[model samples]
Target: MSDTVLDEWQIALKQKKTELEKCQKEHHVESCLKCEKLLNCEMRETYVKAVYDSMSKGKGGGFEF
Candidate 1:
């Protein structure tokens, strides 16, 4: 994939992570349920892992396998 695409995906993943965190913090179980379900979804994880893997290859982002 192109760097621009990868960057966009990375930004999206970060946005999703932030949304999930907000839902969890606000005690929005329903929101969190949706977020958790998405996070656990195969496609979502794939994207997340791709971004994490790329970041991990750089200055060591501390992502656990």
Candidate 2:
């Protein structure tokens, strides 16, 4: 692939990742029991970040953000 095409693909992938993170944050706020159980705000933030990182790769298959 040409450099331009590769760059575009990278950008699109990054945008999708951002969108996925946003959706996860919204869902966590609304329904995640683990998030609700969080006592410290920082820990909750870290947990959310970890969850996003883990699930963003589409590892388990059929699990869309």
lDDT of 1 by residue, 1-21 (tens): 555554555676677677656
Evaluated at residue 31, the lDDT of candidate 2 is: 36
Q: Candidate 2: worst 10 consecutive residues by lDDT?
A: 56-65
Best by lDDT: 1
Taken over the whole model, the C-alpha lDDT of each candidate is: 0.58, 0.51
- With candidate 1 superimposed using the best TM-score fit, by how many Å does residue 48's alpha carbon deviate from the native? 7.2
lDDT string, candidate 2, 1-65, tens digits? 55554344345455655664565587566433446445545544554554554555424434454
Q: In candidate 1, how many clashes are counted?
A: 0
Model 2, runs deviating above 4 Å? 1-6, 29-65
